[model samples]
Target: MGTMAALVFALLAVNILLGSYTVTIPDFFAMLGGKTIPGASFIVMENKLPQALLGMLAGASFGVAGAVFQTMLRNPLASPDIIGISYGASATAVAAVVLFGVRGAGVSVAAIIGALLVALVITALARRRGGTGLILIGIGAAAFMQAVVTFLMSRADVSNAQELMVWLTGSLNSANWERVGLLTIALVVLAPFVAVGSRELRGLSLGGDTAAGLGFNVPRARLLLTILGVLLAALPTAAAGPIAFVAFLSGPIAKRLNGGAASLPLSGLVGAAIVLAAHFVAVNAIPGTSLPVGVVTGALGAPFLLWLLIYTNRANQGG
Candidate 1:
């Protein structure tokens, strides 16, 4: 916990201080104190600070959402990104941008609606059966949504398609103070349920019947956690298009770090670190061109995911 906490803070500091337009320590403090320092102030106050803040918020939200979903379903592949929620948001946002010429908060709103609608569909369909059914359906839905996004992109004008593609890649280039506050408010509002749901998640982790034996209403607990998980993923997708695999990867990494014990707070911290570090690399590591943070994370996460699949397969075979 301590290590992850320090890592999150360090990454935040690095993200805010080491952008293209640097913020000296003294100048950062000065800017914080309501004193403008010419070029430094706008870069710090208007750009880097908000970018880092949104990244931290969105990362934490994705981490918690992933952790809860994985624990509930006992499946490594059961992330919002994998199970269609992220795809729903991505598809709707793309359509809004390309077809309807929507921008700004309108895109966010469309993404949120799409995510929530997908969540409703998943829950309604899965309620009649087991979790495996939900997972299969979600994967199918995700593929369908991805195709929708692709078709929309193909139909767009060349310039608009290029611009939409950047947003689709999940860049923080548009991060602003308003988005920071919006994400912050969302986290604050949704936090209590997550805190309560974390406890419920522990019960759910022990299996549905076992959780029921322990006096938790199994279905209710599952629904609450599912709703919370959806919101966590959706709001962030709205703020910054669905970040690649942070949601899928953070929980398992946190559990491994904690010796197979899941800690929501630790997972959230780890997530913040992942996003901030990815953003740093995205901006700095590429010479002559900056890539989206999602591009970097996707490159890193795909290999880890492949290894995890192989490991899980071998373990299941051994069992």
Candidate 2:
């Protein structure tokens, strides 16, 4: 935990000061102190600070949410991105922006509604079918939602489509204090549920029958945890569009680090690190071009996904 905290702080520093226009530490502090420091003030205050803060908060949210789902489901492939929540949020947000002409809070509202609705439907369908069924249904729903998003984008005029694409790609270009505040408030509100429910979550890993035998109300706990996970995923998606795979990658990485135990807080720290690192690479890895943070994460996550598949198959086959 200490290590993760230190790494997060270090990444936060790197994210803030190492952007397009570098700001010296003294200059950054000076700007913060109300002393105007040429471009440093605008760049640090208006752009990099908000971006770094949002990245930390949103990454933590995604991390915890992903850990919750993966732990509950006992499936590494059960991240919100794979299961359709992210797609659902993205589909509705795109619809609101392109079709209904919604902006800001309306778009955020639509994303939350979309994610919840999809989660509810999937839960309803999977009630009797178990975790594997839930994952399969979520995959199908994700594909359907992706189709909807693609179709919507296709119908928009080129300019509109380009603008919408930015959101879909999950850029932090428009980060502001308002977004940081909302995400922070959400994390604060959601933390207690995770704290209270973690015991039930650990029991859940022992299977439903065992969890019930252990005095956990398996269904009620699962429902609450599911709701918590969805909200965690949704707020970040609403704030920064769906930053791809932070949720998916964070849990397994954290689990490995913790010697195979699921730790929500550590998972969140890993999530923050992944996002900050991805953003850094996105803006700086290529010499000339800056891609959306999602683009970089997607690139990083795809190879990991493939490796997971190969590893899982080999383990199953006892190879």
Alpha-carbon TM-score of each model against the true structure: 0.94, 0.96
Q: Model 1, 256: alpha-carbon shift in Å?
A: 1.8
Over 4 Å off, model 1:
127-129
Q: Write the per-residue lDDT of candidate 1 for residues 276-319, one digit (tens) a residue.
A: 89999998886766788899879978998798789988998995
The candidate that wins on TM-score is: 2
- Evaluated at residue 57, the lDDT of candidate 2 is 89
Q: Candidate 2, residues 32-146: lDDT per residue as tens digits? A: 8899877678878988899989988889999999999999999998999989998899999889888988887787789888999999989899888989899999999999999
TM-score, cand. 2 vs. native: 0.96
User: In angstroms, how far off is 135's CA in candidate 1?
Assistant: 2.1
